[model samples]
Target: MVRITDEQIEQWRRDGYVLIPNFLSKEETEAARNGVFEWFSPSWDDYVAAGRKIDKPGVLAFPWDNSGLNKAVLHDDLIDVAERILGTKDIHLRLVRLDEAHLGIKYAGNPSNNSLPDVFHQDWGNNTIGPHHPEDFCSPAFFYCLDDVKPGMAPVQMVKNGLEPNPKNAEKFICPGGSLCIYSTWTWHASSEFEAKEGHRPTMWLGFNRNDRMWEGGRFFTIKATGTRDGWLRAIGEATPRQRELLFLPAVDDEKWTDEMIDGMFKRYGKHGFDPEPYRQAKAKREAQTNGKH
Candidate 1:
């Protein structure tokens, strides 16, 4: 029973983004942070030590390999906001990225020797899938902070209301460890420099898209770059039915929906005080419509 306020919805509609502070408990944030450190830090450190380009493109795929990290991505509050904002229960996880900014890593061949590549741009491009219009809210990126992100800690600078080239109005996402900063994929944003002398800025990037979309740019890149299809399938296999629904795989046909499935749904969602009857009824209607069309 998580809810999004009308004011929050209006803010997103107006600014193309919203920051929900304290969206996760401190315990939840700590668990996710530990999981990332355990699972991703080694490779990330190796990449840095190799003197490879710091601004290497592509994300760390399938961090859900860690069960704790998987749970964070499927956190109820995050899902509720996503579903409400996207205006759909049928959502798909386009990407799960673990991004870290260390104290002294900088882009290669840059004279400034800045510790971050502060490039302001949108996630979508000419080669991206679907319409390029800014009005299309098909994809959204949720950034879950794993550390208290203060200014100069490489907080992401976003142009409020999609306004770019206006430094006076740019909004820096400085918040506590458990905050969730959500923005449309089309919104203009960039990372600030890691001005802190020590420590790391770790954040989990969860990108999602409406299920009806035929193509997802991140999904395409993930499968290609990370060879993660098998791992992803395994992760999904381990998820609960509700979690599987978030993955946006083809739904189980209503004809195949058994008493056991319905009971399981109740057993799971009921604990959260959710009544599943309405969802079940609506699903049945959708099935009826599909069967009729067939």
Candidate 2:
């Protein structure tokens, strides 16, 4: 598993973002890129034919529909980094977006190749939720590059410190394929114009919030899935226990796990590894604490 260093954490706290190069290996990155292309090829057409707006070339709200993509989100390195940054093991997923920019695409709906404008802004602008504390960590946006994000490949531009738009101080996320860039939700950032001479840009995005803030509608992103609840459940059924935990599936007393859910867990993780005893013990301990039992 990849580990986050103290220096990296300090940088994240200071700059509101941190870029980790080569987070995924070459083989893993290629697999993700291929998987994304295959998944989006058919889904994009289906989504548009179903009367949905084709604002982007290949944008999937919940690309977890692909099993490989689902596993990528629960990557041990990513989970470890998220836990270190959030200072908790109980992290909740807020959203998962797959963006694919095909070659010869232009800004907006126009056919011209003028590239998109740069508009740095925070993501929490419209979210009126709790834990509005500016200093407190609300969410971390993770971006995984499936292609080389060079100078003109619509790389993300971020201000050095905060929202002040200082072009001289801005940093472009120019990294090779498989790199991961993690930024705070409050950070002021924008994507640069896609000036790449050739090839397409594909990226995997994952948003996460600390679990303690779940009371303010903890599972907000769950509703953002593109398909029905049953479809989402079916997709996640292929995930392992650790992956399901990242998806915030009920493991303890929050809700009774259906027989299918249990069977799926066993099928994916096996009986020896798919143990629910820890959750049961934790629930009992919580009850004991409430009853003043040491």
Best candidate, lDDT-wise?
A: 1
**Candidate 2 lDDT, 144-231, residue by residue in tens:** 8776776766777788665576555679888998888788767777767666554455667676667776642223545353533433
Give the per-residue lDDT digits (tens) of candidate 1, residues 4-93: 576986787788788888777888888876666655542235445756434332325553345556677777777777777779978866
RMSD of each candidate relative to the true structure: 7.6, 6.7
Q: Roughly what TM-score does model 2 have, to 2 decimal places?
A: 0.71
Worst 10 residues of 1 by lDDT: 99-108
Residue 113, candidate 2: C-alpha displacement in angstroms: 11
Please count the clashing residue pairs in each candidate, in the order shown: 0, 0
Overall lDDT per candidate, in order of appearance: 0.61, 0.60
